[model samples]
Target: MTYRADPARYDSMQYRHSGRSGLKLPVISLGLWQNFGGTRDYPGAMEILGHAFDAGITHFDLANNYGPPAGSSEELFGQVMARDFRPYRDELIISTKAGYNMWPGPYGEFGSRKYLIASLDQSLKRMGLDYVDIFYSHRYDPNTPLEETVGALAQVVRQGKALYVGISSYPEAETREAHRILKQMGVATTIHQPSYSVLNRWIENDHTIDACGELGIGIIAFSPLAQGVLSGKYNSGAKEGTRAASSNTTLRASHVEPRVLEAVDKLGAIARARGQSMVQLALSWALRRKEMTSALVGVRTLDQLKDNLGVLNNLELSADEIAQIDEATKDGQMELHPSPKGWLR
Candidate 1:
């Protein structure tokens, strides 16, 4: 069957301007962090992608080291682009990142001119993209000189390999410095991708959110559901095939602490009162900030994808509801995906 995008795609989903820039991303963007990697997963990933675009989700986020085998997700995305999504390229906001351990040896990872430039090249090849909509340093490289790292990012824009550049999971001070350095180089540091959710408010505690707000950098929160801990999925126990039960996943079963589960149980009650599922509550809470441009979600199935999009139905939270949520979660039971004062995934 030919893939024709929904003519009403732009009708339902909401878009917020990314920082002060002219670019606006859908309030909910799809991320290919997992389950979009395997050769056998292609058909399923394709269907999810189609449904997402049909729902007005224009942005798709990825990283160089996203796949289980590393680099496979981009290959999968490229296959979809070639087969079904090629005609709709102009309607999509495709972004990828580097700066994690991709291959072995010194040049395979980190934020260096050598590694970043080479990684983006490989990513462009793998995704069959002439240029990505956004390219980010996947994590802050304390070992690398910030100048060299930011310089490579600026260079890519000048060379026309990336349309815009961003940073992910960076601490507050480094984020400010990166913005300054990019500004000096005549590039706008467009967005900041951080791990922010009800359970993990590292961005708020560390002042990263304030810094980005003051600097006019848009925020797109990843792990907004604490990798599904807040989804009421693991409140009972580690279900089969959940991220918590899987040893390969970043969110280990051990990470879903007992106290956090208790806190989430209370939240589930509140969600029911508000006529929302736990997933919708978490996502809506993340987007409550005016500075937030989008909330990035990774879905394994068409059902999960549609369920996530349901957050848009009533993103509004009453003041009393906010206070109730704050009190319920303020016990610091937020250890499920607890990020330390300075850094986290």
Candidate 2:
């Protein structure tokens, strides 16, 4: 069931510079953190992956612990690359991360040198690649020293296991320190993946945006749709058999609180005025930033991916529309410090 992509697929979306790097990443990137888990619908996942590539999505985000049964996502991704994408390796930008708990014991997780290095080696083996274009620390480790984590990332670049390094969920202060350390080690911190959306605006207050801008680090926003909250899918109430209704999910049934729903209703009205779906307006807002290199997104079906891709067609967000959205979500209905990684299940 392998698929081949058309050579002209690269012309679909406009590419943006990743920070100050020479690399040009597509505006919309694919992430394998959710639906790619082995236990999920495999045919659906592969179909969506093929569709994304055919639509000019060059970057794919992954991690060592991305499956319900950890490592299955990478294993399945390897099968995908081997069967369908092997020939297009040069045209792709593959990334994987380490930092979360992939295995038992102290050495198996965290920002320690031993853990980061070993996790990446295992990720490479699972994905059947010589090197990943970008490797990230899945999250910041408050317990570990910044120097140790940054040095481990530098070591990977030196070993040729990763071309560039990135950090995820790190604070602005930590980002600055990491950039300094990595630069001193002669390895640049090229990007940062953060959770940003019309519903979630923590990065604006956290200073990560300005810090990364100063350091020339690209920001690829994850969960830019606020896990589909801004999509108006839950506005009519949660449908059965959806990710929102899944009992095992961490998003919590309470996330759709009364205020959250009220905010969505108001936001939906604003989106209708612009003649776009709430999802499109939300995604467009995130990309309107001068420092945003890409918007990394995930989907359970090809239909969802298509709807998301429509954001690029109308990225124009008027000052008034942006103001309306800001006021609607001003109470901050999207701030959740919990790990969005359900694969650890």
Error of 2 at 339 (Å): 8.4
Return the TM-score for each candidate structure: 0.96, 0.94
| Local distance difference test scores for all models | 0.87, 0.84
Off by over 4 Å in 1: 332-345
Q: Give candidate 2 misplaced runs (Cα > 4 Å).
A: 337-345
| C-alpha RMSD (angstroms) for model 2 | 2.2
State the lDDT of candidate 2 residue by residue for 13-40, as single tens digits. 8899989988889999998876787676
Best by lDDT: 1
The root-mean-square deviation over C-alpha atoms between each candidate and the true structure, in angstroms, is 2.0, 2.2
Sum up the clashes in candidate 1: 0
lDDT score for residue 153 of model 2:
95
lDDT tens digits, residue span 161-229, model 1: 999999988889999999999999999999999988987888888888999999999999998988888
